[model samples]
Target: MYDHASRPGKPSSKEEDAPSPDKPPEPPITRIPSVLPDAETSPAATSANNTTPASGYAVGGGEDGGDNGGANLRRASTVPSPHFALPLWRKSVIIMITSFTALSVAFASTSLFPLTSEIAGDLGTTPVVVQVTNALVLFTMGCSGFVWAPVGRLAGRKQAWIGASVVFLLCTAGTALAPRAAEEKTRLKIFVAMRILSGFEGTFFHVTGQTWLADIFEPTQRGTATGFFLLGTVFGPAFGPCISGIMVTYAAWTSILWLQCAMIGVGLVSSIFFLPEIRRPGDTERRKAATSSVLGILKEFNPSPVFKVMLLPNVILTDLTCGLLSWSQYTLLAAPRHLLNPRFHLTTPLVSGLFYIAPGIGFLLGTVVGGKFSDMTVIKWIRIRGFRLPQDRLNSGMVSFFFVIPASCLIYGWGLQYEVGGLALPIVTAFFYAGGLLMAFASVNTYCAEVLPKSRTEVIASKYFWQYTFSTAGSGTIVPMIDAIGIGPASTIGVAFVLLGGVLTFITAKFGLQMQHWAQRKGVGSP
Candidate 1:
């Protein structure tokens, strides 16, 4: 019999193997007790009272020991909770407006594809030059978030969002006028410059919107809020081409940019008044202190939550899986024209652009369903285990990873490749594929947000920054990959990635608690 090395006292019973108390608890939401019971302050709260100066928090006058006063402190720590309920009618109106703004910018980002040929012809440039502008814009958008995330951390969310919209509006107007402003050589330069500027400005809708929702909503309500946010993101890309296709057919290429510019103006005005500033008093102080060189200050601010997450092998592996899944998403968006035009022989922009609806519909439904089911499942899991863990949400992605991604890629790829089915078949497959993508995204993104509730804005922003960077790479390489490998092989590779993502997600679900313990043992962030 083989013997293994062990400590003098027969290795402790496996039953005693629970994570140490010093490690931060799993499911960051549950870890933070409901601001502690008002009347009976815990030791943690008492310690905080001694350590935090009077200036550190906003105070409302109350009976010295009143429980209600504690609630006020909690409120001041984040967005000051609205004392009077917002009228449902007004709330709905703002949500719609914000959603439309996000969709319009998103659509502009991708829709210009269908008009590339028409735009190039009018501007007297090769189509390649016209399309290069798209790539440059997207690449710029990916990096812009890194710069904006820190700024949003410093300035309030509403102000940051408005600033981004202002930039976008100016860039859009510039692009609309660029064709007539210069010679063909200079035309490309102007176009590229405008697109890059627009891309940079586009970062606001993603980072600001996400952080804002975190500020306003409680943990339980977050899934629904995230679902709505996903709708804006999903619909923007899905409908961008469809709208652009119609505009280019009926009007000039300049109309697309002009329309976007006008919409930005409207959104900017509405957001300024409607989107409340959600900066906490504590965050305000931190931002002021951080004014001494942004880079140095951001470095000083702890990234322990993010770094500790990486220390868990499963999280790293799972992030890669998410990256690979995103590769197919950007590739599909980038190369659709190639497949639609040649195989279906769809010549008109309207016919080619209509193809987007199949997937867009799927994405919308997936987000709603995924968000609800993930929340329900998380609640059920907590009951059964008699304990809650943040990794529970990671399990929600398993269904999407194992079934939706691979099946959708294979069917969508093969359907277009052989032209073996009716238009409806491809459309249905596209919808399912999109649904899976959004469902997976809902889980993956929420996991990031929930795992670091205290540093919610930076954590959420960091995730998007990295995710969009993957999107940039996928968008850039899609044409080449499709050209070299052809659709069938390219999709097969995507399917393999989906499988890998599933395996890693399972690891996160099962061993995440243990990993949290290991991080603490290795001296990670405070509990």
Candidate 2:
């Protein structure tokens, strides 16, 4: 039987492991615990009771307390207890709003792709220049997590969401209005600047919004909630082109920006009224101690801590695995346009764009099903081990890693290389390839959020930092690799990387608990 009362940092002994005969055995855990009756009060809460003034904040206890000393402190000081439940309908609304917010940001990032010609023609610039603006938006969005994560840590996540949304809205409006400039160079400069500004919005949706979901949902339900949240992200790129293609056909290019602004405005308003604050005043006070001054907050901005998290074996393995997955992901996204257009002898953009819908559907199914599967896997492991470890969730994605992805990539690549079954085979393979990517992604992504629950925001930021860097590299290099080597060989390389990632994930799952214990013992990555 598992001992629920054991606290982290307490020395292990036979007594600690043995269940008491005097008390009856507790029932198996099927639902989240509603109270932390056996847990200690948070350090901040204890301090507040003594000399420090009460900040009127309630803190929640950790789910499992072993070897999570700093995590316990952070969670106990910041997050509310699961007992403070939101109504089911309210939770549903929050999920919908968050998904929509993610969709709006993601839509803007790629919506410009289908409008490149129209935007170029309107601004008196070349199509390549307009494309560069889109690239800049992506690059800026990837790096902005470093800035937003810390701000969310220090001030509050709720404020960060609203502020980023508002800025995104204003930037969309500015981009829409940029065409009115008299000089072509001025118009181009204004448009690019506004796009760069808008890029800051992406991390809020991807990083902070996911963090918010983690805050509200218990471990049992997180997989499904995360899957739902990922829908916005998975479909955005595919839907962006599809929606923009239609909008540009019927309306002006500027109309796309206007629509983005309206969507963002709705998100901003919804967040302000509906989003709950996970970090209360006492939590902010505790955070302030970590960043006591303006200089202290500036010091917190350094990326060293985020990089230091990579020193942990589990975190590095997770990061590298995510990077490899990203390479495969971008490969699929980049291939259709380049390979399909020439092979099919296609001229229309709409027809080529239609190919995206297949992968989009695949990603959606993968995340939703994958997430629920992950939770089930965790429960199964918990029953077998008689206790839970965060890494138990990783096993759920192994099939995707080992078989589903490799087979799909080979089928997609080799099929296209040989033109074996025309468009149907590759298109079908692409769907499974995308499905496998996201199935693996949902597990790894949720694991990242839970791995260091205390420093989740920063940990997630680091994951994105490495993941996007690889994605940028993949996006830039895949076309060249395909040009130099045959599509089959280029994709074979991606499959090999995915295999390596699967091996790493396996190592992490089998030995992660040991590694985490060692790190805690050595005072490395305590949080």
Against the hidden reference, what TM-scores do the models get? 0.78, 0.82
lDDT string, candidate 2, 1-527, tens digits: 22433334553344444557997755443222222211111122221123232232122223343332223221232345562387777777878889989889988877776567779998889976776677667767778787776677777788878878888899999999999999998999999999988987786678887777777777767778889988888778656776776777668889889999888888889888988877644676768785777887887677777877887888989989988998788667755767888999966557777787888788889989999999898778655533355777899999999999999999989889988999899889988999999999988888888787667777787787777677667766776789899899998999999999999999888867657655665667643
lDDT at residue 85 of model 1 (Cα atoms): 48
- Writing each residue's lDDT as its tens digit, candidate 1 over 1-527 gives 10111123454223234457897544311112222111111111222144243322322213432222221222123333451145655545555666667776777778787777888887778777767778667667655655665556667667677778888888888888888865887776787788888887664576566655655554555566677776877788887887777877788878878888877788888888777776554777777777768575675444454444444444555556556666667777777777778777789788888888888788788887887777766666545432234667677888898998789889988876676786776788888888898788777766655554555455454455455667777776666787897887777877886787778777777765445444545655331
C-alpha lDDT values of all predictions: 0.65, 0.75
Query: Worst ten-residue run, lDDT, model 1?
Result: 36-45
For residue 340, model 1's alpha carbon misses the true position, in angstroms, by 1.4
Backbone clash tally for model 2? Answer: 0
The collision pairs in model 2 are: none
* Residue ranges of candidate 1 with Cα displaced over 4 Å: 1-98, 292-318, 523-527
Quality of model 2 by C-alpha lDDT: 0.75
Q: What TM-score does candidate 2 reach?
A: 0.82
Query: Taking the candidates one at a time, how many backbone clashes does each contain?
Result: 1, 0
